[model samples]
Structures are given as structure tokens and as C-alpha cells.
Target: MLDRLDKEFAFGREALDVRAYRQELLSSNIANADTPGYKARDVEFSSALAGALKQNGTASNSSTLKMAQPVSLSTSSSLAVTSQGHMSGTSTLAASGGSTDDYGKLAYRVPSQPSLDGNTVDLDAERVQFADNALHFEAGMTVLSSQIKSMLSAITSNS
Candidate 1:
């Protein structure tokens, strides 16, 4: 289903989603640059990607283990959400791996020169970052499109 698609195109799909979200966050920051006491917000792409990869790896390993088990194994499964919102699950193989701290997580890149009003939406820096993210997003989308086109060609050629 859609979950399978997400897992299969994990990096490309998730990166696109995160980049889109980051774009929105950055735009909001820029829009509120003149607003007092507004702190700029951005997505921590590295940690998010790492979390997604860990989840996908766990799911793959669990599925493989299930295939090896007997039909009547009757194992119980449970999913636990950590404070940082990462999903952990227990299965027949072993317990969930490890927990992460939200406070000690990656910090956002602060503006080089903060404003008197405490707004940190450096227009120049934000413009550069927006361009870079857009390029990456387009690249990921192009790769995904090529993959789908190839799959379609394969299916049609066999007919």
C-alpha cells in the first residue's frame, strides 16, 4: 500500500516531505521577520532522516523474522512512542533499540546577526537555504519519476 511505497522510496519520499515542510517553516520565519519575539524555526533533516531509516530497518527485520517463525508462533507486538515521537516496537526477535532525548537533539542554526526585536530570520541566509532545498527537492522528485517511468515501461513491454 502507501506505506510500502513510503518504505521502498524511503529516502527520496521522506526527503521530499521534510524539505517541503522546511520550506513552509522557513517561509513563515521570513514572513514574521519583523514581528517581535518570534523565533525562527527549521526542520532537523539529519535526525528526522535517521529516525525514518531506523524505523524502516526495524520493520524489514521484523518481517524477515516473522517469515522464519512457525505459523502458530502467536507472538504479541506493541508499539511505543518515545518522548521525541519516534516509534519503537517489540516483537518476537527483541525489544526496541534505543530512546532519544528531545532537549539534547540537534539545535537550529541561529542568525549571524540577531535583530533588536529578537527576530532571527536573516533574509539572505534564508533565500540561499530555500534555493538549495528547492534544488534537492526537485532532484529527488526527478529520480522518483524516472523510477516510475521505468517500471511502467517494463510492464508495457511485456504485453
Candidate 2:
């Protein structure tokens, strides 16, 4: 049913959302590189993706069991701030095969060269990282779109 589709696409959807968030954060950092006390922030890409995967797995498993009021798969991870001011968050998923723990959730890269005013935005590095994140975001979108198209085609053919 529609619920299954939503669960199946949940991982990709979350990835796209996180990617957009990262892009925005990176853009803000680049725009305020010269601003004092502006700490550059970004989510840990690998962990976020892993968390999404875990959530999907958990949801699917819960669905099969017919549990009354299945646990929400959108639980947010704990935030961890490193000594250098980087923040990390974790997301977990429960699955039939096994549970997945997504370490390194949301984290900001500590600036290699901290400004005297405590600013951590490195113009060059932020720009490069932003571009890379954008590329991955676009790729994720493409994959999701293709999957949707394939599913629609399959449904239409059957009808």
C-alpha cells in the first residue's frame, strides 16, 4: 500500500532533506566567513544517511509484526559537541536482520584556522564542501525520482 511506498522511500527522502539543510548551513557559513563568532555548522553526511537507512529498516520490521502503534522511525539522534566545537548526532534503526547505529550524527567541522574572534568558517573549505554536498544532493534526488518513475510505470502497466 501507500504506507509501504512511504516507508521504502523514507531513507531517500530524509537524505534529500538533510542534504538541503547542509547546503543551507554551508551557504550561511560561506556568507559569514568574515563575521566574528560565527561557527560553521554541518551534519555528518555518512551518519545521517545511515540513520535514515536504520529508520527504514526499523519501520519495515515493525510493520511486519503488526505491532500496535509501531515506534516512530523519525527519532532524532543525540547531539554531541566535540572539544573543537563540532557537533555530532546519531540515528538508529531496528531491523529484522539487525539494528543499525548511525554514529557521527550532526557535526560541524572545527576550523583548522580559528580566527581571533572565534570564527570557524573557512571560506575555501566551506565552498568546496558545499559544492560536494550539493552534488550528492542532486544525485540523491535523481535516484529518488527514477525510483518513483519506475514504480509508477509498474502500477500503470498492471492497471
Candidate 3:
């Protein structure tokens, strides 16, 4: 029953998480606009959400027991560790600063107008992205809330 609930909401859950993470990235870019060579960073939302869905097994093979199980990246053999002492990819990203370890796929934003300080962050672009992402995040929250409310109403009616 719990797994069913998880699988049902996994997509929306992951979508919200990615949106929030993107918000952070955009905010960071805007905040560091004056920093030299900061290089604006932002995540590709569709790709990130798709990857998360695959990890959650919600995008494919939903009937399998693996659905809703978190994938262990440490066990992935494709990852090449330069040194035994080196931290995992997620931890490394978190340690570097802003972005979380989840969906460690931030892309550098291309600047429309080059800056003398070498900073790629465009204030106008960042502001627009931030607002758009925030709106999406709020919409996701509302949808999730509505789904839960509907479920509760159904359960209560049956009781």
C-alpha cells in the first residue's frame, strides 16, 4: 500500500525536488553576478526529472519491486574514482557549495552578452528563470496537495 502511494506520487515528488534545486541554482547565479568567473550554473529540468523518474522506477517497469527504491550510486562500476580518498560525486558537488548531490548534472549557462568580469550570469535571465521555476514549484505543490485531499475525501466517504 505504501509502495503504491510512493509510486503514484514519485513523479510529482521528483519534479518538485528538481524545481526547488533549480531555484537554488538560479538564485546562486543571481547572487554571484558580481563574482569574477563565477560562471552561471543551471539544471536541465526535463532531463533531471526524467533521470529521477528512472531511478525511482516510475518511468519504466513500474510493476517491479525495485520501484520506489533509491539507486545506490556507490555500487555503480561506471564511476571512475581518481583516488580512493576522493569523495563520492554527490558529496563532492555538495561540498563545492550550492547545488545538492541529487541530479549532479548542472550545466553552465551560456551568456547572451559577454561580461568584462568574465561572469556568465545575466541578471535579467536569472531573474526570469527564478520566477518561472518558482511558479512551477508552487503549481506542483498545489497539484500534490489536491491529490492528497482527494484521497482523504475518498477514504472518509468510504468510512
Question: Which numbered prediction scores highest in TM-score against the true structure?
Answer: 3
Q: Residue-wise lDDT of candidate 2 within 1-159, one digit each (tens)?
A: 756776667667667755766676788889998898988888787776666555545434454211223234545777667677765656653332212233235566787987899898889999899889989989998999999999889889955
TM-score of model number 3: 0.75
Model 2 regions lying over 4 Å from their true place: 52-60, 63-106
Model 2: what TM-score? 0.65
Better of 1 and 3 by TM-score: 3
Give TM-scores for every candidate, taking all chains together and pairing residue i with residue i. Answer: 0.63, 0.65, 0.75
Query: Per-residue CA lDDT of candidate 1, range 105-133, in tens?
Result: 43455879988988877888888888887
Candidate 1 has a TM-score of: 0.63
Once fitted onto the true fold, the runs of candidate 1 whose alpha carbons sit more than 4 angstroms away are 1-6, 56-106
Tally clashes: model 3.
Answer: 0
